[model samples]
Structure formats: structure tokens, C-alpha cells
Target: MALLEVKNLGISFGGLRAVNNFNIQIQEGELYGLIGPNGAGKTTLFNLLTGVYKPGEGSIFLDGKNITSYKTIDVNKAGIARTFQNIRLFKQLSVLDNVKVGLHNQYHYSTLEGIFRLPRYFQIEKQMNEKAMELLKVFNLDGYSHYKASNLPYGQQRKLEIARALATNPKLLLLDEPAAGMNPNETAELMETIQFVQKEFHMTILLIEHDMKLVAGICEKLTVLNFGEVLISGKTSDVLNDPKVITAYLGE
Candidate 1:
């Protein structure tokens, strides 16, 4: 069964349909790309999947279970996590703390236990810290665990966001324009890091990226959107070479 399935999904703001009849099916451990021009509704679709906005039409299924209108926290609990186009780290918090906060949903200790510092609370805290550190190590950010999130270079901050999302133990990870600001070297490293995280965590990834080279390099399948609808969906080489995709990128 597919890990995630979006069937004829759509959403609109007033009379303006931002996403129209969008659909995708992602199997476990698959790495896929969603590409589109600005205002093509890529982020709006992400919002629908992540529960930031309710879909005006269609349904979403995860692990064969319907989750079309679930709450945001409910969606997270159902094994979906995402990073935004804009970095959303807690700037003042230590990198480790920022990741630890992501574990809050998974942590089982009660509020009373936390306030009282019960033995179970301490035990859970220890486990969370260890897991957070392990994630940092995987992303090669262990040395910066104690650093303030805002103080890290822009690239490291992006890595931290991925690490934090991993803390949710998701089955599917949605990365929105993870390479927005970086030199070629940094973007190259991020490509490898993304692949590594998918393999190491055994997670499916659906990424939205503008960099054709980056998308073509990493994504096994590509979906192109324009003006809120799919232009093409196929192998990276095929979709990238499509006349419609070319026209969308470079108008006549």
C-alpha cells in the first residue's frame, strides 16, 4: 500500500482556486519531487496535506486510512511531518532543545510528572536527549548541538529543521524548498543529506524544489505543476524535457 495518497485534492481561497485536482501517491521510502512556478499552488498543497488548510475537495489517506480533515497534531501523530519554505527554528533555543521540543508529542510523561521531576520523567528526558543527539550525529550537527539555532550558518539551520522533523518519527516527510538559499556546494551536500536521511530513517520524502538540477539529481519521480494544476508526472528525465514544462518555465 502507498504510504501517502492524495486523490483529486483541491483547495481554494474565495473564488481563486489555489490547488486544483492535485493527486499523488507515494510509496514507502520513495523520494519524489513537486516542482512548479511561483503561485502554482505547491505550498498550498503542502498546507492541505499538513492540515494547515482544509481541502476544498477530495481526500487524503495515510497507510490506507482516511485522514483528509484531521487536525495538525493528529496528522503528525499519524506519521506525517514537514519543514517549511521559511526556516521555523526557535532562534533563542539551543539546537538540541529545539529538536527536543519536537519530541514533545511522542513523550509520554504527564505534565505533573514533568513538574515534579518524577523518575519516569527523568527517564523519558534521558531517552529524548539521546535520540536528539543521535539525530544530530546523523546530520553531522553533533558538534553544534549546544549552539543557538539562530547562530548557526544558514545551511546548518536547514539541517536542524530536518532533524527536528525526524524527531516526530514520521513515515512521510514533506520538505518545502529545502535548498532555497545556498551555494552550489551547500546544495550538493543537502542533496546527499536528504538521501541519507530517507535511507537511514526509512522514511518517504516528498520535496518541493525549484532547482531543476537538484530535483533531477535526487528525485526518482517528478511532478510539474503550473497555474494550480499538474502539467506532467513521470520520470525526472521525461518530465524535465516535456514541452509543456519548458514552456511553463520559459514562455513563448
Candidate 2:
């Protein structure tokens, strides 16, 4: 079965059908791309998938179990995590603390145990910190672990956000424009990091990227959206070369 399947997905706001009749199926460990011109509802689709916004119609299944109406936190616990187009790190917190926030849900200690600073709390906190540090190392941010998140360079800030999301231990990762504001060097490093994540974590990834170079470099397959509807989906080479996709981006 597909790792993620969405059928007849749709949503709207006040008579504007922002997204309609969307459908896709992603296999486990697939690196899939969601691409379209601005305002194509790519982020809206991510929100629906992550439960930031519930779909008005259609069903979402992860590993063959329905998760259509699960709330955001529940969705994360159910194994979906995402990074935003805008960096969403806790700016004032230490980089390590930012990652630890994602690990909070995994703490099994009772509320009283946490409040009283019991042994379980200390044990779990230590484990979480070690795990968070490992994730920072993967993104090459270990050296900045003690710095405030806002103190990192813009590119490092982006990596920290992804590290925080990974700390949730998700099976499916949705990245929204992860390369939005990077220089060429930073973008290159991001491609390598993404490759490392796919190989090391063995996770399914759905990426929304406007940078064709990044998408072309990594995505095995792609789906194109136009006016909130699917224009086409196929192998990366075929989808990018489609005349409809070209026209959608460059105008007829």
C-alpha cells in the first residue's frame, strides 16, 4: 500500500475553491515534489496534510489508516511532520531547546513526575537532549547548539528548523520551500542534506519548492498544480518537460 494516499481532496474559502479534486499516492521512501507557480495552493495542501487545516472533502490515509481529521499535534504523533516556508524556529530559545520542543510529545513521564522533577523526567530529558544534539550534528549545527536560534545565519536557521522537525521522528516529512532564501552555496548544501535525510532516515518526503534546480536535482517524481488543481504528475523529466507545465509557469 502507498505510504500516503489522498483522494478527492478539496478545500475552499468563502466561495473561492482554493484546492479541488486533488489526488496523489506516495510510496514509502519516495522523494516526491509538489511544484507550481505561486498561489497554486501548494502550502494549502501541506496544511491539510499536516492538519493545520482540515479538508472540506476527501480522505487522507497514512500507512493505510485514515487520518483525515486528526489535529496537528495528533498528526505529528501519527508520524507526519513538516517545516514551513517561513522559518518557524523559536527565535529566542537555544538551538538545542528548539529541537527539544519537538521531542516533548515522546516523553512518557506523568505530568506529576515532570512537575516534581522526578527520576523519569531527568532520564527522559537527558535522552532527548542527546537525540537533539545528534540531529543538530546531522545538519552541521552542533556547534551552534547553545546559540539562540535567531543568532544563526539564515541558511543555518533553515537547517535548524528541519532538525527540529526531524526530532519528532516522523515517517513522512513535508517541506515547504526549504530553499526559499539561500544563496547558491547554501542551496547546494541543502540538496546534500536532503539526500542525507532520505538515505539515513529512510523516510518519505514531499517537498514544495519553486527552485527548479533543487527539485530537478533530487525529486524522482513530481506533481504540478495550477489554480489549485492538478495539472499533471509523472516522472520528474516528463513532468518538467510538459508543455502545460511550461505554459503555466511562463504564460501562454
Candidate 3:
């Protein structure tokens, strides 16, 4: 069965249909791309998948269990995690602590235990620190683990956000325009990092990216959306070459 599947998904705002009849199946360990023009509801679709918005119709399944309208926290617990197009880190917290936030669901101690620094709290804290560090190292941010999250440069900030999302141990990782503010060098590095995530974690990733080069470089398949509807979906090369897409989206 597909690791992540959406059937007849849709949503609207008053009279505007923001997303309509969307459907897709993403297999485990596959890197999938979602692309479209601005205001094409790409991020809105992510919101629906992550349960930030309850769809007006249809269901979403992860690992074959329905999670259509699960709460955001519940969705994360159910194994879906995502990063925003606009980076959303805990600015005042240490980089390590920012990642620890993601690890919170997996590690636990009672409120009193945490407040009193009981043995269990320290034990769990240690394990979480170790795990958070490992995720930081994957993004090459371990050396700056003590710095405030707001202090990181833009590219590293992007990596930090992805690292935090990965800390959740998700079955499906959703990245919304992760390369949005990157330079060419940074975008190139991001391509490598995405491939690394796929191989090292055997992750299923669905990303919304406007950078065709990045999408073509790492994505195994592609889906195009226009005006909240699917235009086409197929192999990367085929979708990129479709005449309708070229004329309407690529403008080539």
C-alpha cells in the first residue's frame, strides 16, 4: 500500500475553491514534487495534509490508516511532519532546544518530574539531547547547537527547520518551498540534503518547490497543480515536457 494517499481531497473559502478533488499516492521512500504558479494552492494543500485545515471533502491515509481530519499535534504523532515555506523556528531558544521541541512527543517525563529535575526527567532529557544532536549533525548544524535559533544564517536556518521536522521520526515529510530564499549554492546543497534524507532515513518526502532544477534533480515523480486542480502527474521528465504545462506554467 502507498505510504501516503489522498483521495478526492478538497477545500474552499467562502465561494473560492482553494483545493478541489485532489488525489495522489506516494510510496514509501519516494521523493515527490508538487508544483504550480503562485496562489495555486500548493501550500494550502500542505495545510490540508498536515491537518491545519479540515478538508470539505475526501480522506487522507498514512500507512493505510485514515487521518483525514486529525488535529495538527495528532497528525504529527501519527507520523506526518512538515516545515513551512517561511521558516518557523523558536527564535529565542537554543538551536538544540528548537530540535528538542520536535523530540518532545517521543520522549516524556511527568510535569512534576520535569519541574523537579527528577531522575527520569534527566534520563529522558539526555536521550533527547543525543537524538537532537544527531539530527543537527545530519544538517551540519551540530557545531552551532548552543546558538540561538535566530542567529543562524538564512541557509542554515532552512536546514535547521528541516532538521527539526526530521526529529519527529515521520513516515512522510512535507517540505513547503524549502528552497524559497536560497542562493544557487544553497539550493544546490539543498538538493544534496534532500537525497541524503531519502537514502539515509528511507523517508517518503512530498515537497512544494518552484525551482525546477531542484525538483528535476531529486524528485522521482511530479504533480502539477493549477487553480487548485491537478494539471498532470507522471515521471519528472514527462510532466516537465507536457505541452500544456510548458504553455501554461513553464512559459517555454
lDDT of 1 at 36: 91
For candidate 2, write residues 1-252 as lDDT tens digits.
999999999999989999999999999999999999999999999999999998999999999989999999999999999999988889999999999998888767888999999999899989988989999999999999999999999999999988988989999999999999999899999999998999999979999999999999999999999999999999999999999999999999
RMSD of 2: 1.1
For candidate 3, what is the TM-score?
0.98
| CA deviation > 4 Å runs, candidate 1 | none
Error of 2 at 59 (Å): 0.9
Per-residue lDDT tens digits for candidate 3, residues 1-252, read: 999999999999999999999999999999999999999899999999998999999999999999997999999999999999999999999999999998988898899999999999989999999999999999999999999999999999999999999998999999999999899999999999999999999999999999999999999999999999998999999999899888767576
- lDDT: the better of candidates 1 and 3: 3
- TM-score for candidate 1, please give it: 0.97
Residue 247 of model 1 has an lDDT of: 96
Would you list the clashing residue pairs of candidate 2? Answer: none
lDDT of the candidates, in the order given = 0.93, 0.94, 0.94
List, residue by residue over 82-187, the lDDT tens digit for candidate 1: 9999999999999999999999888889999999999999999999999899989998999999999999999999999999999988989999999999889999
- The worst-scoring run of ten residues by lDDT in candidate 1 lies at 195-204
Any idea what lDDT model 1 has?
Answer: 0.93
Q: How many residue pairs clash in each candidate at the backbone level? A: 0, 0, 0
Give the least accurate 10-residue stretch of model 3, judged by summed lDDT: 243-252
- Scored by lDDT, model 3 comes in at 0.94
Please estimate how well model 2 matches the true structure, expressed as its whole-model Cα lDDT: 0.94
